[model samples]
Target: MDRSRVTVVIVVLAAALALPFYAGPFWMGLATQIIIFGLLALSVDLLLGHTGLFSLCHASFFAVAAYTTAILQVRYGTPTVFAAPAGVLAGTLLALVFGIAVRTRGVYFILITIALGFIVWGVAYRWSSFTGGDNGVTNVPFPSIGPLAVTSHLQYYYLVLAIVMLCALGYRMLVSSPFGLGLRGIKASESRMRSLGYRTALHLYVAFVLSGALASLAGVLYVYYNRFVNPVTGSFQISVEVALMAIVGGSGTIIGPFIGSGVLLGLRNWVSSFFELHAAVMGVVFIATVLWAPDGLVGLARRLRKRRTGIRKDPA
Candidate 1:
């Protein structure tokens, strides 16, 4: 990375590392949530931002993975090792099936994903016997691997941070790799990419699956942190919210989703305490973001910095 990016990263890391020490339990919990949702938003962006495919069913993969891990750990006495991977695998498998949606583009793809998401949500809601409907699964123990275990929320936060950081690094590498470039090319023009001998459908399908796997990973983190699984976890609203988080935070940028998560979650927590219309407040924020900062906060910041630089270089 360049010097400026390295510096900004160091600063952000320092703040993340120091937050728990300075903040109270509530704030710490909120921070953890932002990180988790950020990962989900990032996954959505893999399709929305990089590949120009807007998927609305990511919460299905997320919920499936979460439910899989929760069911295994709570009902069957499965170890975290087995349970977690099973969760990711289940979600990825769902993604593979859902990958067929990529054959259609634009609004059709969005509608299909919405339908697929509802299927998972309906199953979770109606199939109470297997999914623990309404009450859902509860009292999920913190993950443990023989000698190593997360005994408290703080430790879990650190674990999540480590995992998210590693994922971010890997994502950075992926976006810079040849395959990542190919996705971008497809995003720009499927016809052009096809002319260049790239199997655009295959490319989009692979990206969709990879995106689902990442969303599934986020779900695993969320289930462990929340200690439960429910239909709400896979609801269409969650898919919309996370997608909004990506757009509000600045799609196509690594740090943007996390920042967007922080803004939305923090605002909700603060506003809901005093205002019954907190959902309305969130709506206003989204509207404002769309109107004034279409590219997102990160993009706006970059614009401001460029403007300042230009002013500094001016003869006057």
Candidate 2:
């Protein structure tokens, strides 16, 4: 990474670490939610930003993982060690199935994902016997493995922060590797990539699965933090919201999703307090982003920095 980027990362990490000391419980909770949703947005960007796929069914994987974990723990009394992994596994397997949509492109791919997502939402809403219908699974205990247990929200926040950091580090390596470059190439020109002997379809399929797995991890963390799982957890709106977060925060960058999440969630929290039309406010924000800041907040910052540097170097 460049020195400036590294410095920015350090400052962000320091702020995150110090948040608990200064922020109240409500703010901490909001921060946790932002991180979780940011992770989800990151997963979506794996396809939308890098692979040029816009999938709307990611909530299926996320909801499935959450439902599996909630059901196992609440009804069957499964251990965290087993339930968590099972949740991830279930979501990955679903991703494997949903990845077939990669066979199509453009609007068809988007429609297929939307259909898949609705199927999950329908089942979650109607299958009251197994999924608890619209009520969803509740009273989920904080995650515990052996003697290590999260006893408080503060502790859980730290745990989440640590896990997200590791995920970001791993994601950085993955994006910097050749595979990441290949995905970007495919995004630019799939036909050219295919002509170069790359099995572009298989490449996208793998990325889809990996993205689903990441979203599943986010869902698991969310269920534990929220202490409940509902059909809304797997709603189509969530997929849309996260997609917007990616675009608004600057897609294809590691921190963009998180920044977008913070902006959206924080805005919602603040706006919803007195306004009943907070959703409209979000719409305006998105429209403004598309119209004025097409490349998003990060890109805008970079452009401003470049302009300043150019001015400083000008002889005139």
Candidate 3:
């Protein structure tokens, strides 16, 4: 990372750490969800935005991790430490399994993922005994990492923020590493990268698993925070929302999704509280974001930076 990126991360970490002391319960709860979704968006960014893979079926990977943790903790009496990793493992395996077939590396790849996603979703919603069908797994235990107790929503918010910040940093490092650079080269020209001796397929599989793992981590945190894990948590619509948050907020950058999730989630909560047509309002914002800011909130910030530096260029 360069100096500016370092500066940005430092500032963000500082702010996240400080939020609990300043923000009220309502905002704290909202911020917690925003952080979770932001991590999900960033995972989508890793495979889709950075690697140029158009994946829409990530909900399968997401739901599997979540439900796995729910089953382990709620039914089998697994500890939180085991539950988190078990969830991650479940998600990673799902990614690896589906990825082997769908790693075709383009639009076909997306279709394959969608097919897998539908299948998993069906199992989640239809398997009433294990998943509780629509009710899901309620009252998920609060996570206690070693000595730290993460029970309160506000306390849990900081824990999530810390995890998200750390994961984002790790993601940035992975993208900057040689393996990461190889993925970018593959995206630019897979044929050329293959000719250059890069194992493009293997790189994509690794990225896919990593993305799945990160999304699963977010799923575990989501369950812990809400004290609930429902089949709807892994629903297709929620998958769309995650994609929208990533695309609308900006992906592949550390802060863009956070900014996007923050604004969009805040608006959604506010709108849902008052109106029957909450989706209609959100749809308007989504359409506006796509039309006016295709590159996401981060893209808009980049434009502002360029303008401040006196560079003349058309946004469109």
Candidate 4:
């Protein structure tokens, strides 16, 4: 992380730690949801921003993980340790399998992925025996790792922070590795990468698996934290929110989602206090962002800095 980002994260964490004392249950709960969703949004950015692949079915893995965790705990009586990994594993396996087939060039892959996401959502909605149908699985237990159980809202918030940090760190390492370099290569020129025999499909499969796993982890955490998992968690709403956060925060960079999440979350919260027109506000914000600030907030900041310092233009 850069100096500015490091300082920002420090300040954010400090603020999070103090939230419980000042905020009421509603606000604290909202904060937890924002952080969890933010982590999932970061995963979306990992693929859409960095790899330049539009995988729209991200919520598929996320929902699958939630169902698996809910079933394990509510139906089969599995322990937290086992349930969490199972959720992640379910997501990874799906990503690996789907990524391979959907790694086609052009818009074909995007369509296929969108079709698959709906398929997953339909299953979650129809499968009443396992998923509890439209009601989703409720009373999903809080996980206990090494005898430390997260049973309350405050405890769950901290647990989410720890998990999000790990995901962020892991993503950072991956982006800094040779494989990440290959992704940037593909993003820059897929034909050139294919000429070099880079097996773009396989690389994408791996990226999808990692990305899906991260999203699923967030889903599982969301269910556990709230003790309720709904079908809407698998709905397009979740996917749209994640995509928006990534775009708004400045994708391809980990810090972007974190920053974007905070802004979006804070804005939503502040608006909910005064107006009943929250969705309209979000829609306007989203449209304005795409039209005027396509690079998102961080992108805008960088442009301003360059203009102010008058960074020398490249020699023609």
For candidate 1, give the lDDT of residue 190: 87
In order of TM-score, best first, we have 2, 1, 3, 4
lDDT of 1 by residue, 219-305 (tens): 999999999989999999899889989988889989889988888888899999999998899889878887899888888988999
In model 4, which runs have C-alpha deviations exceeding 4 angstroms? 311-316
Residue 169 C-alpha lDDT in model 1: 95
How many steric clashes between backbone atoms does each model show? Answer: 0, 0, 0, 0
Clashing pairs for predicted structure model 3, backbone only: none
Candidate with best lDDT: 1
Worst 10 contiguous positions by lDDT, candidate 1: 132-141
TM-score of 2: 0.98
For residues 31-53, what per-residue lDDT tens digits would candidate 4 score against the true structure?
Answer: 88888878888888878887787
Worst ten in a row by lDDT for model 3: 307-316
lDDT of each: 0.94, 0.92, 0.81, 0.82
Worst 10 residues of 4 by lDDT: 307-316
My TM-score estimates for the predictions, one after another, are 0.98, 0.98, 0.92, 0.91
For all predictions, the C-alpha RMSD in Å is 1.1, 1.0, 2.9, 3.0
lDDT of 4 at 65: 86
